[model samples]
Target: MVTRVTNQGPLTGVRVIELAGIGPGPFASMMLADLGADVVRVDRPGGGGFGAFPGDLLNRNRRSIAVDLKQPEGRDLVLDLVAGADALVEGFRPGVTERLGLGPDDCLAANPKLVYGRMTGWGQDGPLAQRAGHDIDYLALTGALHGVGRAGERPVPPMNLLGDYGGGGMMLALGVVAALYAVRGGAPGQVVDAAIVDGVSVLATQIHALRGIGLWQDPRGVNLLDGGAPFYDTYECADGRYVAVGALEPQFYAELVRLTGFPPDGGDGPQDAGAAAGGEALDRDDPANWPALRAAWARLFRTRTR
Candidate 1:
């Protein structure tokens, strides 16, 4: 399995230091370790009192070191580790690392080639830089939450995957790798400011392109890819379960019609009583026709367990 294999290929000799936190930090470290980087997670004394199950895959492929940064001996030990390391990742809000005397400046002073990566919700400098926020807040600030859900419905959260993992953690890892490559030749000591808000905006690149075209609309549930296309959305199966429909293209639509045994010329289309009352075709684009189409599709699926 892709999840089980380690040391298979690539990133075999890379060294990375991860300052433990939550969400993005652990995810980023997991990716790095999966790709064969030797990642050492620096945890606080007594494991920071976080509740986590044993055998957590995120903490796998990594070694843990307990350190008390408040003490001079512990601080020296971390600096010593930095002296021979390639990169370091931290996910504290703005100035927390600097306050602990383990900031980029201090780490870079010890090892000039260190690629210091900082991950946070809001960035290193801004009005809300120091404020505590989570993934939903980050997505909200970046205009990502606005275009998320159905029309007239409340914005649905896409979990932490979008803001934390996609934007913050992945960006930090990429920045670290790029900086490491740059410093291998020259240009030592780089800092990567990876914020969840910034990363989410960067991820909106394709969405912006869709908006530039006439196909995308500002209103939610009216766009092609955002649950607006009736043919591309989920439908209720007869068992009260759900199945997705994706007859986007003509060929797929023909296949769907053939599979469902709908008439080729669109004749006798959807014999549902609701559609018969409306005198409409079972076309997905027509909202008034969806109820009928849904009923017909439900009847078809009811014969099968799925």
Candidate 2:
């Protein structure tokens, strides 16, 4: 068994053993360690599939120990460590830990008050739980990717932010904290099944609300919050740099219009918005005129330095 070290924070007294993996799992452990938990990462003999970089910021604020789980002694050593730990976080396939004899059952048996946190792409017991996936796959499956990008273009991948960190890691950290809190309140430690797919779906709660209210359309990049709105999207400046505009409110849009010196009410001169709608003026409120207004804004913004 490895020696324990005390840390300082809200979770100062908490102990966490992380079975080191990649991406979201490490990210979650980093958060726990940052919050004052004594997070000890268990790496394989060589490495944890990924090479170690001295500048790996994701694994900061944590200690690491290499253990050969294939060895009976090594497995026993981990179980011994689990006996004293407050939590164990693992991000493996559905049955990888079970096959290694360190599943939740094994850890919980060692410490009933232990919080067993599981991170995965799908979930613990879903149809695709055993399937291989990544952040992009989870985002695609959860309908999060479809809503991104321009109207006629393919969906733009938001890197791993949406699925790996935002959905998976953050959610896992939250669940672990909540579970640890429950243990402090005299509740038995439980497993936290944090799946990227599940979390991504939850992150789309507002999108779901928009859809239900009939304000959001099914197509991508055409909604008010999407790039469809002239005032809510980014524009290329004169210097070829892009500036993001999020003036969604009418007052903000009016201010934006005033500041840009683009003709007020979309005409050569200031005029009533209703009067300019029928003319060549770019009507900001009309969805049909979005392309035209966007063209106008693009032209206007291109004349200004970013």
Candidate 3:
């Protein structure tokens, strides 16, 4: 029998209070819960009255408490809950929680050590912070969308993975955990301003480094890792599906040549027999040679498939 050992989690004793809205707030809470934290989600009365069942996986792994914050009793109820909580997460656009009388000031006044985590797109102080936006718009402002897609084509949106989940929600979770660590040694209460645009820019740090080192080109699909090198790209097979080829190093390229039956001694191998007859060897760096290589790979895949 294959045994899988499941150890007790790192956040087994941590407690978090989540003010439910949508997107990053619930996702951060779910990550905390997955690490064994006790996260309580405070939902609006009538159970998120604005929509249908919030069956999103991000909202799972937490207990829900419906309360009407418009009423004084509900405000007092949240204050009571805050008294025993370690952290609170909210994703309202800046002043919305303050208007609801449940902002960081209100919660921290009750619990001096509370770590308040705020999630948004443009941040807490920018002019567009209060304006409405989504993942694509946020990534567009950060130049992340421009770095994607092929050359001479419109920028392809990467389906909310970049801005909302990676930049907004995951960044907030990291901030909350860091704040908790800081507060363990007598650090006072604090707020984490996690903006999607800001985090997306931070996520581009490696690309920026590549640009500084002259490794990254201006145009998309014209760099080594960006589909410029024919050896480091995908090719269509005979079945019209695709297979990725990433033989960057010399040894890996040699292995790829051996496996594909290309030229082992700078001459053509069995795989490039047709091309060799035409006075051509498999040169992966040459884009003009891609068609021949692609045809050979297609023939190999076609013969193997039923």
* TM-score against native, each model: 0.86, 0.90, 0.84
| Model 1 misplacement above 4 A | 1-8, 49-53, 263-304
Please say which candidate is ahead in TM-score: 1 or 2.
Answer: 2
If both were scored by TM-score, which would come out higher, candidate 2 or candidate 3? 2
Candidate 2 lDDT over 1-306, as tens digits, reads 345355578888788999989899999998998889999889888773653565688888778899988788989989998999999999999999998999999899999999999999999886898898888899998999999899989999998899999999999999999999999999997999999998999999999999999989999999999789988999999899999999888778766665556654343344444433333345577898887778877887887899
The residue-by-residue lDDT of candidate 3 on 1-306, one tens digit each, is 112122247887788889887777777888888887788888887765332264667777778888888888988888888889999999888898898888999999999999999999999986797898889999999988887877677788888888988998999999999999999888998888899999999999999899999878778766667665656777666667777888888568666666555542343235464333343345666556655655555455544422
lDDT at residue 34 of model 3 (Cα atoms): 88
Tell me the lDDT of model 1 at 73: 88
> Which candidate has the highest TM-score of all?
2
The per-residue C-alpha lDDT of model 3 at residue 124 equals 92
Whole-model Cα lDDT per candidate? 0.77, 0.86, 0.78
Q: Model 2, residue 301: what's the lDDT?
A: 81
On lDDT, the stronger of 1 and 2 is 2
Q: Over all chains combined, what TM-score does candidate 3 have?
A: 0.84
Report the lDDT of model 2 for residue 19: 90
Provide the clashing-pair count of each candidate structure. Answer: 0, 0, 0
**lDDT accuracy of residue 250 in candidate 2:** 75
Output the number of the lDDT-best candidate.
2
Clashes of 1: 0
